[model samples]
Target: MDTHIYTADDLDAAAKDIVEGKLVSFPTETVYGLGADATNEDAVKKVYAAKGRPSDNPLIVHVDSEEMVEEYAMPLSDEAKSLIKTFWPGPLTIIFNLKDNVLSKTVTGGLDTAAFRNPNNDLTLSLIKKAGVPIVGPSANTSGKPSPTIAMHVYHDLKGKIAGILDDGECQFGVESTVLDMSTDQPAILRPGAISAEQIQEVIHKPVLDERVHVADAQVPKAPGMKYKHYAPSAQVYIVDSPKDFEEAAKWAAEQDDKVGVMATDAVLNNLHFSNNVESFSLGSDVLSASHSLFAGLRHFDNESDVKSILAQGFSNDGIGEAYMNRLNKSAGQKHFNK
Candidate 1:
């Protein structure tokens, strides 16, 4: 398959293809999304096949406006409404009860809830409007791999597998949206992104943290993406909290007699010592900056064959740190080295 770059004018054509059950890769403020018509089961399945994503992992539906969101999701609570007023057209995803007959079972992974977001980017919003359909869009990459933040990242992972890509440049957030579960009595964060829990609590007047891990029954799930090991790299990843612990762990990792790589902020990099064969890359100091560089850095390390293991520094569990930690944790998987 040939990957075509779409300009603003090509958005209509892209939307047309999406309506016909074709997968169209487009940009969002957070990352590029591989979009399919959410109401079309076949179209949503195409997304799963194109990116090699598991059917059990759920997709987030993108709407052009709040009214569009209301059509698919149940009436929003005052808290959900407040959040939308402040953060819609941005990197915020709200999980709510699905309206009857709105989304296909494939879109919600046969669950009663759905994840929805109204993206701020012009190209994506226009495509949503033109398509005139709620789009089930996940990050445009193979499941369990790094999420694509730029159009090329999409091409790199999906070039031969998908149809076309809309290259609007690098994503602003460089990660997925902050996902809040508003369907329940207590609002909880399903996924963290640019919007922090503190910011959401400030508006809702309730405490919120990361949602507890729930084992989804294979038959049904609130969202499919929640059930899988995601954002993994080829090399094993380990996370340590403080600079001292990271140094010690790096020493230990080096002593393993394997070529290791270190992923941390510039400050942490200055404090660690590794074998001359080991390479170090900075994910920036703050969580937001780290989130931006996380996937690209992993991809860089993954491409280098000599780098056998990756040691990462733990991020603060605040603001964007919540999202950063989620991705980091998933990437590290069983390789996490807590101290």
Candidate 2:
């Protein structure tokens, strides 16, 4: 299939494709999401096939309003009500028990519960409202690769495989939404993202279970990125834990047989002098900027075939830093700098 990028002026056409059960990639505040009408099983299966995503990993249902949630899901809890009031139309995905035979097994991964969110992007909300159906959305990229924050990144991975890309430029958060399971008595966080657990706890007046710990098990994941290896670039990534480690890491990279790439903050890059073979991408000034640049930087080096190793920066896992490190650690395969 030839993929055409649809602009804001042409969103009705994009919605038309989605309504007809064709795969369309759309923008979200978090990342670009591959969209298909959740009511259409064939459309949902094509999403898994296009991205090579495992069938058991469920997709998030993106909708335009809370009424849409009530239409398909079981009654929402008091806490779920509070959370939606606080963080709806943003980067928080909540899991709710499904009404019998409401959504396809292909969309929910055969689970009784489904994850749902309303992204803050206006283009996406308009598209969902225009299509007049809830859409199942996973990140728009090949499975196990960095999530696409820009529309071109989606094109690079899924050009001919999908119908069209709803291009609204670079994503704001540059990461996926936090997946929270509210089906249980206590809310559990399935995946960490821009919305921290502490933020969720404050809104609900309760502690959120950090279930990011149970990810490596054999059980089927309740959400995407839980049971799969994600955000991995083609090159080997070594995470430098501290500014002190970068000096030694540079020396080590100088001795390597192939070219090296560096993903670091402006301060760290200014102080270090790498060999000519080393190419660098700035992670901006701090952790917030680092989160925004993480996937783009990794993709930057993927274009440079000569870069066999990437020495990337790491920050203290707090606030949004937790989400940043979670993706960085996966990309680096938990390998840290010691040289």
* CA lDDT, every model vs. true structure: 0.82, 0.92
Per-residue error for 284 in candidate 2, Å, reads 0.2
Q: How accurate is candidate 1 locally (lDDT)?
A: 0.82
Error of 2 at 162 (Å): 0.5
Q: Which ten residues in a row have the lowest lDDT in candidate 1?
A: 216-225
Which candidate number maximizes TM-score?
A: 2
**Number of clashes recorded per candidate:** 5, 0
Those runs of model 1 whose alpha carbons end farther than 4 Å from true positions after fitting are 216-219, 271-273, 304-306
What tens-digit string does per-residue lDDT give for candidate 2 at 1-339? 899999999999999999999999999999999999999999999999999998989999999989999999999888888899899999999999999999999988889999999999999999999999999999999999989999999999999999999999999988789999998897898888988888898988989998886455668788888777789999899999998899999999889889999999999999999998899999999999999999999988885456898999999998999989999998888889887
Cα error, residue 24 of model 1, in Å, equals: 1.2
